[model samples]
Target: MTHSSTAPTDLPVMLPATYRGPDALGYCRWLAAMPVWALPVMAGLVLIWPTLVHAQTVYSTEKIMGIMAKWLPLLITKGFSMNVVISFFTMLLGTIAGLLLGVGRVSDNRYIRGFSWLVVQLFRNSPWLVLLFIVMLTLPFEIRVAGTYFSVPDWMKAVFGLSLPIMANIAEIVRGAIQSVPSAQWEAAESLAFTRRQILWQIILPQCFKRMIPPWMNWYAIMTMATPLVSLLGVTELVTLSRQAMEAEGNNPSLLVPFYGFALIIFFAYCYPIARLTMRLEKKFAVKG
Candidate 1:
């Protein structure tokens, strides 16, 4: 008998073959170069596939669609409007408070500067939820404003809570923007015998406005997102309404993903445009500088 050795090429392969399709290099380059929309289309089809199969089996597609159709209008009109209203008041209150504190931060008096600094630090360091709870649960239900008695709404508490951190952030923005102005400009104003207030109002603050706007819009987007947190305080915002919709569907766990996904879409649709606008404004202001 003669001894025989197998060549490597003649041996049976034990390793799995590598995948070689459109994903492989030099294989269907056109597929690789397909438009990005194809990805979302494919992904969306895949995402809905499970739901489709389940609905076909369980006959719940029409039911889910019916629920969604009913809730959609409420979410858009009432829930979204509530979110916007709370956010607007929050921004208004925050901006006014922040402007005051920011100006106070740079004041000649040490007491005013210290007080503003303390206020900023206190609110900035506190957790937003803690502030929300404090405002919503701890504050008296009825408050006397301008000597008139009125009941404070839960949504108002949400705004008040949300504004605290916003105020601090805007204060910092204001302080930094004001301080960033060149000392030469201040000296020029002083040489003209202009009062500090006049110099600030006419020269410094005006310049700060452009700088402040970009950050202000950025913060507005953030605060708008945060508005959903008000739902935790029993305010009927988008997220809260979404929850109610899901529950109304007999607490169907399957509906959770769809409902929440719907809310996510709305938020993205709302915020993404604002974010893009903010970026554009920032670039425009930057180029002007």
Candidate 2:
């Protein structure tokens, strides 16, 4: 205590208030630079682990092969055609409905706007499964358009049921995108003496379309996956074919796993490339904030 030395009271000295250790600094940099491989690895593990753990010990090679042979032919013939037709019709109807609702959402007319809001609220708030059931099983039985009576074949009804909800969702997306375009753009179109239709189709719609493509692509992919739901309504689509194959397997429950799994794999294989393309389009069209 007696030998202790003290600096002058007024002297300034610099000392670090805090230190970021090298390990901490390196960790932040590592995280920033990390590759995106981890997520895919995790997803693959999650998808594969259940199958591996639950696979039956008494695997019949003939049963597996026979199921594959029977399913593959039908899948290539009827299943493929039905999927393509359903997807096309759904996309067509959804696009038209979305465009009209989107325009109505931004309309100056109160009636049009209110009606659009009501449609969106009614459809969007309901569960898609419920909507499908109503359209397929209940609507035709309950509601008649005229003395002529409107009826849809079960296949067409399935398409309509699946598509209507999707269209409602898409309408909101399109409306939002259109509204997001600068107000100045609308004013410019007006100043140029463009009619409302001209302004919308020429200036706003095109720009909105670029913005809309990503979401539309994603929705299309979802719709493609959802084609299986058509089977519930007696549409002899892919899932229906697979179900029939499973029944043909008779008492062997083990075949159920492979049959369904193979069907799922087949659908995934068809849709995966489309999903990848959509992702690429999303990246390409992403607007800078």
TM-score for each of the candidates: 0.81, 0.74
- Candidate 1: residue 8 lDDT (0-100): 54
Which lDDT tens digits does candidate 1 get at residues 1-289?
A: 1324444574446334444542211211232234435545544653474466564455366666677778889988988889889999999999999999999889888999999999999997688888898888887889999999999888888889999999998898799889989989999999999998889889899977988887787778878877888888899899888888777768876666667767666665566667667767777887787
Measured on C-alpha atoms, candidate 2 has an lDDT of: 0.70
RMSD in Å for model 1: 15.0
Clashing pairs in 1: none
For model 2, give the 10-residue run with minimal summed lDDT. Answer: 23-32
- As a TM-score, model 1 comes out at 0.81
> lDDT tens digits, residues 1-289, model 2?
2334555563444322344443311222332233446445544543453355446635455545565676778875777568768888888898899789978988889999999988988886587777888888765643466666665667777778888877887788789888989989999999999988888889998887877776676677677777888887778787787777677767356666566665666656566666666656656776332
Model 1: lDDT of residue 262: 70
Q: Which regions in candidate 1 have their CA more than 4 angstroms from the true location?
A: 1-59, 145-148
Q: Per-prediction RMSD in angstroms?
A: 15.0, 12.1
Candidate 2 wrongly placed segments (more than 4 Å): 1-59, 139-151, 287-289
